[model samples]
Target: MTCDEQTFTMKPGEFQALGTGEIAYVKPMTSDDLTTLFPQAPRMRPGLNLWVLLNADGTPIMLSDSRETALANAAEHQLHTVALH
Candidate 1:
């Protein structure tokens, strides 16, 4: 450690709460992954590319064929998006 270096610690709960409502996650998905992550989604053709906007806690908010649409939806809901992987 150096004089200019600093460290901050947070409890597990606090860390998890960091982006409760203000942040969301954007994940790219294949049709195969859709059924598992979004059971409510309508059946679609196999091997389709898709994007999903999820809350900070991994709850699906919206699904779209276009990543832009997912991101736009997140912004519409006042959420900042982050890449999941």
Candidate 2:
């Protein structure tokens, strides 16, 4: 017996909007990366570790020094969190 496989595809925009406001991700970042990823963030000393919560489309939601806080923020917004790597 042989099994059949399913195929799926999406337009670039659709793919990027897959989760949209429904899902978010927590990313571990350094102060050095904040300027690029979250430009509005205030300047901070380099080498400090931080956690950032971002929307599915890579928009910054909030930044924190604790991953738990980031996740809590996601929960507060009713957004599901996705693990990276």
Error of 1 at 62 (Å): 0.4
**lDDT digits (tens) for residues 8-77 of candidate 2:** 7999999999898999999999998989887677889999999989999998988999999999999999
TM-score list, all predictions: 0.76, 0.86
lDDT string for model 1 (1-85, tens) is: 9999999999988887788789998888899889898887788888999988888877788889999999899999999987655
CA RMSD of all predictions: 2.6, 2.3
Which whole-number lDDT from 0 to 100 does residue 30 have in model 2? 94
Question: Which pairs clash in model 2?
Answer: none
Alpha-carbon local distance difference test for all models = 0.87, 0.92
Please state the error at residue 3 of candidate 1 in Å.
14
